[model samples]
Target chain A: MESKVNKYSKQFILFNSIFIFCWLVISIFPFLWTFWGSFKVKADFFSRADWWYTVSGVNTLIETGGRSTLEAYINSWIEGEFWRAARNTAIVTFSVVTISLFLGTLGAYALSRSTYKYAFWILIAALVFRAMPHITLVSGYLFPFFQLKIWGILPTTIIVLVAINQPFTLWLLYSFFKTVPKELDESALIDGASYFQAFRHIIMPVMWPGVITAGLFSLMLAYNDFTVTALLLNQQNYTMVPKINAFLGTVEHGGNYMWAVASVVSATAPLFMIVMFFQRQLISGLTTGAVKG
Target chain B: MPHKTFFWFFFPSGLAMILFIGLPIFSSFFQSLHIETEQILIEVETCDPFGCEMEVQVDQEATGLLREESPLGRFNGFGTYLDRNHLAFDDLGAGWETKTSIRNFISIVLNLPFYKSLLFTLTFCFSVTPVVVCLGFVVALSVNALAKSIKGPVIFGTILPMIVTPLIGSLVLFWMIDAQGILGATLQKILDDPNLSLKASRNLTWITLIIYGIWHNTPFAFVVFYAALQTVPQEPVEAAIIDGASRFQRVRYIVLPHVYPVATFIALICLMDNFRVFEPIIGFSAEGVAQSLSWMIYKDLRNETLMLFGSAGATSMLTILGVAILLTPVLIRTWKEFRTDR
Candidate 1:
């Protein structure tokens, strides 16, 4: 038992611990520092006098009459109109996730259950589609969209995002559906239920875990998207990622660097919470396809 | 499933893909074959103080009418693809004819915008993927040996870099490495060069972006590899240990084979993702130093006054071609596997 427990040498263990400690610092320090500095004024955050000024918030106190303030948050959310972008993001993500999962489950269920050669071909075609860089597809959309007068609307962006997300969502859900026994659905079919009926009544309840996982990924894709949103949508319909990008352009003249920082922290907060609560699901989703392969 | 059932099940997804993803490739190809119409010019006679003068002016109304009439513009057939900003066939021929040596020819090729971006994209993709795989494996192995109590928090910290928005993650690191920020100041103090800036040098910018790529992507590989490591069969490891195998030997023999498939999967994903690297360039303001294929298309479409739709379309088509080439190996492998399965 002792030999089993102490398999590695003491020196090896020491080195491993040190390496992990360094890695943790490298991984976590940037976010911690940025989160801490988001509350400070620009002068303190990017202090020329001393790095310690950031930690102590000396310049923040001098500028805002306190150790820290919500000046940047208020400035970004209200003055910069980041809330509109946040709302746009909310709408886009909700629609994309719901639509993607709806279409994906049906398609993936068919692909998984079928042994036909065309189903394999469809999956392969999806693989190719998934590999295409999204910006390339956006370039193709611009001319037609401008002609159709649908270039800058939320629905256009949602539909395009759902399309772009389908290949991945389908692939993921197909793998998950493959894991579920075919007999469960076939049994329902033998009882005279139609395919759609079996899918709705028999399969969906057991499919939530997979649906939620795929939904999470689809949500991330829509939320973190910049290329599709930036290129397809007009300024009024900008999402948070592109809106944060717009903030960078105004930073030089408006001195709104802290506002951008505050917005970034705000944008990351939800993702942080999602990670905290759904770490297991996230990990499982990432490895699902790989494990099967 | 019957054909009818399958069609009904797959209709919505197929329609979406066909309309958006499938048709766009053809649309981009068609758009790439043409350039926008030149501004319409008309001669106008004006009476000056001395004499009547003839002047040529752009007729915006006529140009607008023409654009409205035929938004596809006049066909230029493969002209846009071979232009200086794209494949640059003429420029390559010129460089080949005038070069003094191989090195000089390589420099000339890199001088072209398209090839320069291609080089950077390929360099970024190849360099970042392997480092990420290796580092991720090491981290996975190390974390797997840690006491279980701290594993959860450690994993939470590890994945933060990956799960955060790429642009935001890069911006976070960008601030910390700004000239006056903590890391930047520490480096300047250590080197005793107050004027030192990571953003100023081209090579340094490349290295910084590559480092950012590795940091952002390593966590994904780590999580996958760690999960794979968890499922590694214990019997083989126990037998090897009973046979007095060294720790290094046991790992080399037992663990590596188990994780090889996961590593390949990681590499494939890394290559695909890294090829489309764009947001970091904007976040780091490194556009002056490095650009990727996606960034090139973005620049073309984002032109302030007149969007260069044809130029962007040409680049988009070529980028799609590059993606096809990158995917060929995996596609071929899948094809072969499919055949064997049949």
Candidate 2:
């Protein structure tokens, strides 16, 4: 029996090792390719592929093309307008997060404790609204403003984004708030603390993680979004994704491969920074709040 | 003490939602019912290399109508349902005409593109969700099963892929599949079949996408399942284990039932996200074969006669119903669990 158990244990270890290797290779290699490609010079990229590391002076010939891999990195930085796109993304993310956080917390508090007959309906309706594709809503959403001749498309977009993001934010915050002991509210009430006071003093601190999680998700969603921005923003007014997409198109059309790599790198910088900074919280929050909600 | 405070708390969200979400939806529904003059038809008098490829541009202004026809071309009271009277055009704008017939909705539902998308979404959701859940479950259960020393790194390693932006994930996949890429070269040799190019083949694209999506999304499921598993009542699991039930059997009877709610929740959100998926399709559509519902809506809006209005609205309604139907069983099961727990 002991020998059989040992054999099973060994087989399990071997199976797991193979699975882990495949999983790691599959998940990590793509990002690595992107990272490496970002450093390749445009001129040598194609040639290097055709005559890769022949080592009969091939490496030197590839290196002498007056183009460095780092050129794409620099070119993408300048040409892709990374700074402006980053600024636009930051503004959108900050505004959406702040507004939704405030509204979601309040709305969630109400839905959590208030025995209103319509609360469930409100939640379900919000979910349905959020579930509808943004592309479906873009024309109708922008039409009213178009008729009124309101040209501030960016601000209008932010408002729409906040509205769409609220459903998930509110749902997540409500769930978190519900997890807090209700006696906290009861005690605060006994002490003459109003609902607002109870929320601010008692529940807020407990639910801070949930609020942050929702905020991060909102930020990520806004930052990573491509379709709506592509449809709404003009060519001259490129967001991060549209800019990356343009470079991608250029590469597909056999334009500068170097520029494409650079664009991808610059576009992903904020994402990388956010992930590195908030890796743990982001993962946990993603599952609990975003997925589970 | 009074109801006013509750109103204040609830009213803003409700009102804002009504104005922003509800209002647009209803107005779009209304707009679908009107005759649109914005439809532009262009007639090209050309002597082509093959023959004269004459293109006729229909001007909506000629009809003096706000829309080409009432939505669905028929009149239903207040446009609450599909109308058949509004479709007056035989073929308004060359091969792309104002389809003001029941065929529009029927085609939207039954056509190859819609079915392709539906199949893609179903296979996608099913393929990805289980892999994610299983991967997540393994990571979560193993971590919980492991000694404290081995848990941390495994958890972090498993979660590393989930933090990157989803769009970035696709871009990264694109680069990896380039001809000279490390795996690309290896795959070129191993998957020598010409059909295996992840960039070109729709089936390959779907598989690659599901794999990438599962890799990115599993960590999320893992974390929730992990956290929920931690909260699962230990006594029942221990009792089952003590009954000489194997680990798999114990998990089947004890751990699975406990984790079912979280799994259902993840599955629900995943279904919605997958159904509305546009980015991966857009990213992967270099060959233009991957036309999803969201992409179709985008395409329809660009048509000159605005042929998309009825179909898009109908599609959205159908999609909502699909979601409701898909989630009903899970919803019922969840409600039962919650009630029993209470």
Candidate 3:
């Protein structure tokens, strides 16, 4: 019996080693390749038959004619207009996150704690709404927006994003709010605090976990959105996803690959920071709907 | 709580959904039924100075009447939905009827934009789900067996592919598939074909996109399965081991059953998500080689002069119908669970 256990453990170790080794290589290789390629001159990136040119020969930065990747970043920031796209992304992410959190907290609080059975039905409706492909929603928005002359504007897309994000926000926050004991805040109303005030002073601090998770989801949604913003926003209002796509088209057609890689690298810098710090929250936020709720 | 409290609390999100989701769904349906047009008239201007010009102009009164009839568009109920850009039922029937063989018939059908995109979308959805789920399960098991101290970094690495923005993730990998890029160069050398290019072939493009789909989605499934693994009851595993079961037998009888529900959950979500594959084709600039249902809609709306809202609206309806078909089983199952629980 002991011999069998030992033999199985050895097999398991061997299997796991192979899986992890393969996974790590596939996960890290592309980003490392892109990161390396981003610093190489346009000629090497496009013309050279060898991809090892960056490491083998003197790697020249495509932007600013420098020898370092820093100039590539600067060009992405300035010439590629990623800074503008970043600023637009920040505004959209911040607005969508804050507004979704604020509204989601209120709505979820009511939906979870209310004795009214209709609140449950409202959540089911939100779930259905959430399940629909968002392109359908964008298609719906086009004509009304064009008729109203509100199309191709940042605020228009922001509001649409907030709306698309509502169901997810409410669903995640509802589960989060359910975890908090109702008695904790229900007693505050007996002490003369209104429901809103009870929610404000009593429940707000405890629900931070859910709020943060929902905010992370919101931030990721707004940050990574390509479909709606790509369709709805005009050239002047393009966000990071669409902006990088534009660079991909323009540069790939023009035979300049460096700018596209540089822009992608710059666009993803903030996400790397977010993942490093908030990996736990991001995972929890993503799986909350699946596993818990 | 007062009854009015529900209203006050839910009003904001409720209004947002009404304005955006609820209204748009209704509007999309209505838009699918309508086809907008300009009321045009030819005006021949005769100038006294011996020059005459003829110009086609939009008839303002008639245009206003058209807008008044339906601000979204003129109500051509179901016409756009059946047009050559959409269902094209007659054209499809003719193509199928005229073909000499199955391969010729398929080629004819695939030439239709809507059918071509549907072919790719369904192919992507059906292929990616099972592959990602199985890969995810293996990774989950492997991660679960690792030393506790090393697990954190391993998980972080696993999640990195998923964490990158979808467009950028596809682009980062799309660069490598370039003819001059590393993998492309390696493949060229390994195969001894100097002229081999991923971009130059449709079949290779589809495979690369499928591989990208699996690469991007596996981590999410892995994370979910890993979380589910923590809750797996250990007694059955131990009992099976003591009963002279092999490791494979134990996994088959104990561990597999434990994560079965999560595997199903991930499969359902993956099906729904993969049905809307859009960004990769755009990111790779492979629109010429591949198109998705979502990309098809984007194409219609991005037309140079006319936005083609009517065509986009019809395609959106079809996409919504596709999603509904995918979602029905899950919805029915959930409804059953709710009924039984109550």
TM-score of chain B of each: 0.94, 0.70, 0.90
- Mark the regions of model 3 whose C-alpha exceeds 4 Å error after superposition: A1-8, A57-69, A190-192, A252-256, B38-73
lDDT of 3 by residue, B1-342 (tens): 688988999899899999999898888887778776766575756566778777667677877776676666667888987778888888889988899999998898888889999999999999999999999998988888787788888888888888787789998887788777778888898999988887789999999999999999999899898888888787777777789888778778888988887888899989998998988887676899899999988888788866777888889989989998988777776666656756
lDDT, candidate 2, at A71: 57
Mark the regions of model 1 whose C-alpha exceeds 4 Å error after superposition: A1-7, B42-56, B339-342
Worst 10 residues of 3 chain B by lDDT: B38-47
Off by over 4 Å in 2: A1-18, A42-68, A185-194, A197-207, A251-257, A283-293, B34-112, B143-150, B191-200, B233-246, B302-311, B333-342
What does candidate 3's lDDT look like per residue over A215-290, in tens digits? 8888888999998988898888899888887776665444335777887877777887888788888778777777
- Lowest lDDT block of 10, candidate 1 chain A: A1-10
User: Of models 2 and 3, which has the larger TM-score?
Assistant: 3
Greater TM-score among 1 and 2 belongs to 1
Docking model 3 quality class = medium
Docking class of 2: acceptable
Task: Give the winner by DockQ.
Answer: 1
Instruction: Please give the ranking of all candidate structures by lDDT, highest first, separated by commas.
Output: 1, 3, 2
lDDT of residue B60 for candidate 3: 79
